[model samples]
Target: MASKQAQRLAARQQLQQRMAVKAEEERRKRTVLWSIGGVAALVALVLVAWGAVTVFGADDDEAGASDPDVAELVDEAEAASDRCADVEPSGEGALGTPTEGLTDGRPAQDVYLECLQMSTPDASATESCMYTSVDGTSPTPLSVQPAAGTQKMTIVTNLGTITAEIDTAGAPCTAGSFTYLAKEGYFDGQQCHRLTTESIWVLQCGDPDARGAIEAGTPEMAGAGSPGYQYEEENLPVEAEANYPAGTIAMANAGAGTTGSQFFIVYEDTSLPADYTVLGQVTSGLDIVEQVAAAGVM
Candidate 1:
C-alpha cells in the first residue's frame, strides 16, 4: 500500500508541473499576440489621423491655412524646389533633362524632379455627385449622376500605361464625359498633341484630330476640341500657393465651362488660378510622364 501511494504522488507531481509549464507558454503567446495587435492598431490610427489632416486641408480656412506655422510649412514645401526623387525611365525617352525647348528659363530639371517627388499611388474614396447644367454643345453622358463611386481611367501609351482614379464624387460630369468617350474609343489612338515646357508643366492630349500636330503643332491647333457639348465647372481647388500639385490630371479649358476632350497632366506644382476642374489624380505609371518631361519637348 505504501509503495503504491508513493508512486501515485510522484505521477501527480509530474503532471502538475507539466500543466504549469503549458499554462506559462500559453500566457507568453497571448502576450506576444496582444503586443503585435497593439502595434498594428497604433499604426492604423496614425495613418488615419494623417489622412484626416490631409483631407481637411481641402478647406483652407478649416485647415488653418492662415496659421503662421501652417503658412510656414506650405512655404517650405513650395520653396523646397530642390527636392527631387530619383526616377528610372524604362520607357522610350531620355533619362536626362535640359532637352531643347523644355525650360522657360528656370531650372526645368528642378520642376520635373519636384513633380516626381510629389507623385503617389493613393486613390481618393470620396463619394461625389455632380449635378449641373450643360450647354448641350456636344455629346454628353446619358445620366450626369449615374452612380456614386470612383472610376479607373487608364491611358495606354507607347511609353507606358498611366492610370488615374477618377474623382467621380468631385467631378462627376467631367468623369462621366471622359468615361463615355473612352468607352466609345474616342481617346484610342489619338496623339498626345501638345507638350508644354513653360510656366505649366503638362502633356495635353485627348484630341481625336491630334494628327499632323503629332510632331509640329501651332499654339492654337492642338488638343482643343469638345465632343459636342459643354458643362459647368465644379470642384475647383481651394486657394493655395500650388493649387495644382504634380500627378494632377485636370481638365484643360480655355475658360470656365470650356472643358473639351483635351486634358492636361500636371508634372509640377503650378500656381495657376483654380479655374480648371480637377479630373482626378495619377495613381500609377507617372514615371512615363516624368521620363517624357525629362526628355523635354520633342
Candidate 2:
C-alpha cells in the first residue's frame, strides 16, 4: 500500500512540471510576436515621414524659383516714369507726323512714333542697351525699319487664348519684334508677372524667366527679363488726352526707347502719359485679363 501511494505522488509531480514548461514556452512565443509587430510599426512611420519631407521640399524649391515682389514692380514703374521724362522722339516719323507708306496694304497713319537712339557715354562700352544680352541666342536688332501692315497674332495661355490685331503701320518695329519672338517660342511657358487694380488697371506679361501663374512667392521676373536685345519705342500718342482704352495691347518698357519683350493689356480706359508703345488691339480674350484683374493679385 505504501509503495503505491508514493508512486501516485511522483506521477502528480511530473505532470505539474510538464505543464509549467509548456506555459513558459507559450509566454516566450507571445513576447517574440509582440516585438516583431513593434518593429514593423516603427518602419512604416519612418517611411511616411520620409515621403512627406520629399514632397514638401520639392514644392518649396519650385516656389522659391518663381516668387515675385509687388513693391519692386511699383518702384520700377515709378523709376521708368522719371526716365521717360528726359526722352524726346526724333526720326523720319517722329510723334505727330505721318509714317512713310509701306508696300504692305495698310493705311498711312496720321501720327507715327519713331525710335531715337540716345548716346550712353557714361555706360560701359560693352553695354549696348540696358538689359540687352549680347551672348543670347535671339536674333540681333535690325538697323532698318520693319514693314508696316496689319497682322493677326494668337497668344495661347494656360488660362485661355488671346488674339490681337497688330497695327504694324503705327508701330512697325514693335510688331516685327513680337512676330520674331513668337516664331522663336520666346513667350511659350512664360508668365504674366504684374496686375494692377488701382490707379492703373492692366495685366503685364511676356517675361520668359517669369514662367508661371501669379501666386504667393512667385519670383518677380517682370521688368528684369529681356529678349537678349533692346529696341527703340514706337507709336506714342501725340495728344494729351490720349488714353489706353480697354482691349489695348501695348509694350512695357523701363523707359522711353527701352522696348523689349514685356507687354501689357488695358482692361479699362486708363489715362497716363504716352510712354509705352501701342502694339495693337486685342481682338479676343480681354475677358481672361478681366478675370485675372477681378481676382486681384495673389
Best by TM-score: 1
The TM-score of predicted model 1 comes to 0.54
**Model 2 pairs in collision:** 66-218, 66-219, 67-217, 67-218, 67-219, 68-218, 68-219, 68-220
Pick the lDDT winner.
Answer: 1
Model 1 over residues 83-170: C-alpha lDDT tens digits?
2223232333223345475453222221111112211111222223332334545445543132235666666565666777777667
Model 2 lDDT per residue over 60-155, tens place = 433222223322322332333223233232222111222233121111221111111111111000111123444676555433223335656666
Error of 2 at 179 (Å): 1.1
Instruction: Return the clash pairs for model 1, or none.
Output: 128-169, 137-228, 137-229, 138-228, 138-229
Tally clashes: model 1: 5
Against the hidden reference, what TM-scores do the models get? 0.54, 0.52
Alpha-carbon runs more than 4 Å astray in model 2: 1-138, 212-218
